[model samples]
Target: MPESDPLQPGSPESDALFELEPRAAETVGFAQLARLPLTELVAPDWAEALAPVEDALREVLAFLAAEAADGHEVLPPPSYLLRAFRQPLAGVRVLIVGQDPYPTPGHAVGLSFAVDGRTRPIPRSLANIYKELDADLGLAPRIHGDLGRWAEQGVLLLNRVMSVRSGAARSHRNRGWEAITAAAISAVADRRTADGGPTPFVAILWGRDAWSVRALLGTAPVIASAHPSPLSASRGFFGSRPFSQANALLQAQGNGTVDWELPPLP
Candidate 1:
């Protein structure tokens, strides 16, 4: 069953607003992440987990606001920042971390490498990912690039730095997002079952950037591989079978496997 929204309208959860933009935000509650505008769109569980890095989040947001004020084009519109958390944190059955948001203007929807469609040519890394997905899941590739379905099924499709300046990849790397997300990584790692064991969620760490969070993942099953970038894909990503492997691990842990076959886009 789909989980009930804890941030329903008119409830106290909706009243807790930590506004990132001057305009009205969503009806969603920020939970413990109420202090950081960057995480305000996340689920209550994720927000609460992010509480420890509130100060780091604040610093990051302030810097972003300042950058915007300086006339820089920050990609992945603010409204899409928390799309990855739409399914809520507690429901997270898988975690896939990317390095940063796409540098192209319309290429990023805030869920890390996912574009709006699978047109003529997409990012090299994304194309590589699709190739691997096809090989691992034994499913024909769809032309669309939207990965929101994966996110809806409890995949935390997060990026190390959630946003980047238009045409400038890794522009926000040195900003405070690393610290804030590091804390998030730690919190997710800390999630424990009734028997005090690691949760069933599987972590797929691609490349060094994503692997950096490995230390914080505790005992969660990890499927580490070379990045699905043209530069490194041939080295390891091509035959990694991460999608199948991740689902296999989840099943071994007594959890439902993810349906990696994405549906066609309208």
Candidate 2:
């Protein structure tokens, strides 16, 4: 099956709302493109090529917007942000597809999730996973540097639901967000490859909600593991090994090792 309700809650209303948004029409059209910061946005080539599928994008956005208007409190409409981040989709080899944005204020910036290395603590499971991997791989310091190094090799960090506005925090809303995330990933996966080839993308699903969307990935080769939170650790989701596993898979597929460049924490 194609993974039901990638958004949290997966309610009928929420889905309907996502279907109504005019993201596609707006993205290609001048008005919508003008709203975004050209420098920060993803380039236009990929999005332009996908213009034929604008209706689908619009539908998803409409459904999301309606849900928010109906008090589902979804994340901010990320269509503009999505367009800005379009560059990665062109030929991205690995995508770390997360669930929704973080619940904390000012963390979700359309496409990026902020994990404050100096302030907000790293999730314990994530920390443990990194520590374990570092130990096994003979890498020391057990810090963000290791993960940062992995990012340089063309690993694109993406959340399923990209934008959650500040002050909109609800468990149910988060569930709805998950559904939106799933829908977004589906959208990207549907894009035709640059050379008219298969879209060879690897997705890393971290956490429980992320894991739940496995069906959406189809045969795209996914890495399903614990959420990297303290809560997940209680359930026995320990391993520094998953990183190595991910690396090995990428190498086997000829994706090569990640660059490990530290992403701006988040």
Candidate 3:
């Protein structure tokens, strides 16, 4: 179920994203990391759990920053990279993992399969998502591709690999992003809500890349289907009804349903 291209970056081609050995952060100290970009960008909600991997995350960001400083264009404008974590962890009821940020400039809003509200002619993959949403729940497709409303309702729309070089899809894979996101996904699967005997949760895994984390979910209900990309949606994604199935899983655990509705702008 991997993406169309799976060579990934950690191979000898791009060098490992994390190497704190002779060439790594041995000399760097707490006081030094205190001033790095990681402290400024990592949301407080995720700070403590992700602390152990802080150095690796910083290294990943440094690589991206270095790429930008070298005049390469990075998508989602940096600020949006961690936007998915703005919601409290306890509030999250659903997890959706996208392969990576959209390669087209301005098309990736940090959330998987989502774009900025003003983006025109939504990406075909996203359009297919809306089509499935309609078929599954009788919901109308939004004119704008912004999925922020879903995030507000406890839907974590995360990209397994968050950043990418403009016009190059999956160019950042195996570049240390996988390690960071894997921790985040595992944390979500393990969380137990305060005062709740059992918390309800659902994961919508659309493709091989997304399904790769299925083992980490530890029995968390999953709705697996083909990726919604125009290339593969017809194969299995269209009739899967993942949206309805997800709600049923959540309700089975006595939790509230996700508000999948995306109303058009006024």
Q: Name model 2 segments beyond 4 Å from true.
A: 1-41, 45-86, 109-113, 116-129, 136-152, 165-180, 187-199, 234-236, 261-266
| Quality of model 2 by C-alpha lDDT | 0.49
Which TM-score value belongs to model 2?
0.59
lDDT by residue (1-266, candidate 2, tens digit) is: 11122332234432233232423322222223223233223445445544554454445445555554455434433433352244455556666765555555423334333333443454454466555555546454233322323433545566655555446543333434454455556655665656765566677777766676677765677876666566664354455355566678778776676543244442
lDDT for each residue of candidate 3 in 58-140, tens digit (9 for 90 to 100) = 77776776666566776665546666776776677999988999999868767888987788889999999999999999999
lDDT of 1 at 263: 84
The C-alpha local distance difference test score for the whole of candidate 3 amounts to 0.76
- Greater TM-score among 1 and 2 belongs to 1
Each model's C-alpha lDDT? 0.74, 0.49, 0.76
Q: Which residue window of length 10 is worst by lDDT in model 2?
A: 25-34
What's the residue-level lDDT of 114 in candidate 2?
Answer: 32
Clashes of each: 0, 48, 1
| Per-model TM values vs. the true structure | 0.84, 0.59, 0.84
